[model samples]
Every structure is written in structure tokens, then in C-alpha cells.
Target: MDPSILSGMRGFGVATIPRWPWFVFLAGGMGCLACSSLSHLLACHSKDFNLFFWRLDYAGISLMIVCSFFAPIYYAFFCNPYSRLFYLASISLLGVLAIIALLAPSLSTPRFRPLRATLFLSMGFSGVIPAAHAVILYWGQPHIFVALGYELAMAILYATGAGFYVSRIPERWKPGAFDIAGQSHQIFHVFVVLGALAHSVATLVILDFRLRLPTCAD
Candidate 1:
């Protein structure tokens, strides 16, 4: 915590930071992974069911990505009220559009896999603008660099996953070789989980830094 805040707390303690953004992220993460696992497990039942569950999985992914934006954006722009509101509103609108497209049966099809991947990539990489802004605003803060390293790692992992998903890798190179193992889809899931872990670490770093400062001082 901020030395001033912590010292003040020593006499009259208070924890005033709102935690809704982080909580939303945790819920979204759980829902995304659960839906993905369930869809994979039950997709073999029938083609219709396969489509439905897969679409649900896509929706879950969208939810997680969108929710993940909240905490970072909130903490990053916390003191800059107008910027915070603008970023949040923009992402919320983009997320709505992304969810609508992902839930569409045609857009969710294998034939449109690249399109879906691009949409996700677009949403993810859009953070570049805000990250750049943050760096410019806090160039002397070492904690910002630490958090940025983790965020970059997340981006790489996620991009790798999207590549595997779009290319239908190892499986596509030798179809039957991966019949029971090493499917591109499985690899994609692995990378996504790894990416999320990286992001969570970054979030923790940022949270720790933010918690140490007075709320309106940044």
C-alpha cells in the first residue's frame, strides 16, 4: 500500500478501493474455461448440439477477453476520469459487436475460423494504444515495465494459439497422426490458458502497484 495510506491505516484503517473489475474478470475466466471444456466434451453428441456448444464456447471466450480489459484499464486510467470512461465505453461496444459475430453460426464455422481469429486479435491488440499511453504517462515507474513484460508474453502466447487454431497445424500436416492426440484445437486451448495465466500475473503486478498509491494521486 501507499506509505502514506498504509501509515494512515495504522491509526484508522480503511480499504476503500472498489474491486468489481477484478471480480468480473475472475468470473469471466471461470466461465470461459468451463464452457470450453464442456463444449469439447459434449460436441460429439450431434452436429446441431456441436454447433450450439461451440457457439457458446465462442461467446465465453469473448466474455473473458472483454472482462479482462476492465481491471487494467480501470487501474491504468483511474485518475483520468474522462479517458477511463472513453476506453471503457469503446471496449464495451466492441465487445458487444464481437459477441454478436461470434455467436452467429456462419461466423463460427470452420470456414470462417480465420475471420474469428482476426476479430479476437483485433480486440486483443487494441490495448496497444492504452499501453503506450500508460508508458508515456509513467515512464519512470519500474512496476509498469514488469506488468508490461507479462502483458507482452500474454500477447505472444495468444497469437501463437490463434495461429494454431487458424492453420489447423500438426493435425493438418498429417491428419491421422493426431487423431487421438496433439490436435491443433487442443494446442490452441493450452496456449489460451497459458496466456490467461500470464495476464493474471500482470494484473496482480499492476494491482499491487496501484494498491500502494493514494487513489486520486496518479
Candidate 2:
């Protein structure tokens, strides 16, 4: 959001950056949200629906996490095909593994809430690898650091959300008071939305950086 952060990087005619990576992220976000909404809405209908939709919800979270990596990584590593491919493949594999792990009906229950949060948190934190790599590659670039700042905010928000989700606070602290409002899960969802917003800003920053100079030579 700060103009000065990107002031140093002069544009060499705006490059026509590919939009597929961005689209992938958007799709993932939408699908994850849809799955979560549906799960919450319909899971109470029946036991069978509960199992099916909750698993779907977990899988959708994995899908969104995996897709979130696309735009940032692809744009940051636009000049290096190998690193790009490796990161993308690694995340894809992790997502698949997470989905498989979460598909277990036992894991979806409140008893395994910690494990579920850990799995999702692990998937989210795995971005540190490529994020660090990008920082190193673009070291001293003001815009990159700004982007990193947004990412850091995203991480904090997500971690906080997960904490509430795992702890089940408010409601846990006072049994009947939070049943209708101020529940931990509701707070968790709020933080999730905030985290997603932060991530979006970071991604946009990276995309703008790449658009300024699409080619490595630039």
C-alpha cells in the first residue's frame, strides 16, 4: 500500500503477466469458502451428511492452501523455471497428503480438533520455504520486504485463528454465554478472513512487482 516501498523498482513497460495463477488462487478461495459454508449449513442435517461434508470441508481447506501458493511463487520465480516447478510440485504433494489424512472421519470430529488444526497449520506454514527463498533472491528490494510484511501479518492472523479454533475459547470458558454469539469458532472465522485478506495483498504486491518487469533480463 505504500508507494515508497515500490519506488525503487522502475517499470520497463508493463508486461503482460499471465492471469492463470491468480485465477487459480481465486478459485481455490471460492471453493474452500463454499465448502465450509455448505458443511456448516448441512452437516447438522444428518449423520451421513455430517461425515461427508466435514471431510469435504477439510479437503477444501487443503485445496485453498495449495492454490494460494501459485500466484506468489509463479510470479517470484518467473525467471527460474526449476525452482518454480519444484515449489509448486512440493505443495501439491503436501496438499494431497493432507487431504488424505483429513478424509478420515475420526480426524474430523471435535476430539481430533487439535490434529486438524495442526494439519492445516502445517500446510500453511510450509510456505516459509519459498517465502524465504524469495526474500533471499530479491534481497534489498523494498517492495519484497513490504510484501513479506503482509505475509507475516497473514501468518499471525492465521495462527491466532487456529489458536481460538483449537482452544474453543469464550464458549469453553463460559458454557452457555457464547452459544449464540462471540463463540471461538466465529472469532476463528473472522481471523481467517483477515488472514486471507492479508495474503491477497501480499500476492498482489508480488504480482505488481513481476508485471513491472516480466522478463528476467529486465
Top-lDDT structure, candidate number? 2
- Return the TM-score for each candidate structure: 0.92, 0.91
**Candidate 2, residue 167: lDDT:** 91
Model 2 — which ten-residue stretch has the worst lDDT?
A: 7-16
Give residue 179's lDDT in candidate 1 (0 to 100). 78
Residue by residue across 1-218, what tens digits does model 2's lDDT show?
A: 25553444335434346779989998999998999999989999999999999899889888989999999999999888899999999999999999999998878888999999999999899999999999999998877998999999999999999999999898988899998899998898899888888989999999888876634673
What lDDT score goes with residue 41 in model 2?
95
Residue 211, model 2, lDDT: 70
Q: Give one clash count per candidate, in the order shown.
A: 2, 0
